[model samples]
Target: MVDAFAEDEEPISLPLHASSDEIGRVFNEHAERRSATLRASTERAIRDHFAEAHDGQEPPERIMR
Candidate 1:
């Protein structure tokens, strides 16, 4: 699992006065950001794998089907 806070970042703690909706928004934003990061990393790994196996040729279009 990915760490919530990076080396220079601080952990988020909700204040006692935080509303339910405000807390939900914070969780949603964090989830979306993490999802995007994972998507990009997955794409890079797939491309690298194809490149090594295909001797630098482009991956076949059929792979997407």
Candidate 2:
């Protein structure tokens, strides 16, 4: 997962006149957006998986002993 954004750490060779702080802020925002997306996707996947796994399943009866 760390490698997924390793490229962001490297300097951008573009000739944009933005300051280093501005560039850093942009990268931070992009990273935050990506993290949010991943979290939402993971939550959906987990919910779907658990729902399918429990489909048509019943709880065990309690013992009276």
- For candidate 1, the clash count comes to 0
Q: Quote model 2's TM-score.
A: 0.61
Local accuracy of candidate 2 as per-residue lDDT tens digits, 2-65: 3435434445443488898888887787778778766777667767776788887653454768
Q: Write the per-residue lDDT of candidate 1 for residues 1-65, one digit (tens) a residue.
A: 44534521434578889999989987787777777777777778788989888895878664654
Q: Tell me the deviation in Å of residue 1 in model 2.
A: 11
RMSD of 1: 4.3
- lDDT of each model, Cα atoms only? 0.72, 0.66
lDDT of 2: 0.66
Runs in model 2 deviating more than 4 A are 1-15, 56-65
In candidate 2, residue 48 scores what lDDT? Answer: 76
Give the poorly placed runs of model 1, Cα more than 4 Å off: 1-10, 60-65
Q: TM-score per candidate, in order?
A: 0.67, 0.61
Report lDDT (Cα) of residue 4, candidate 1: 38
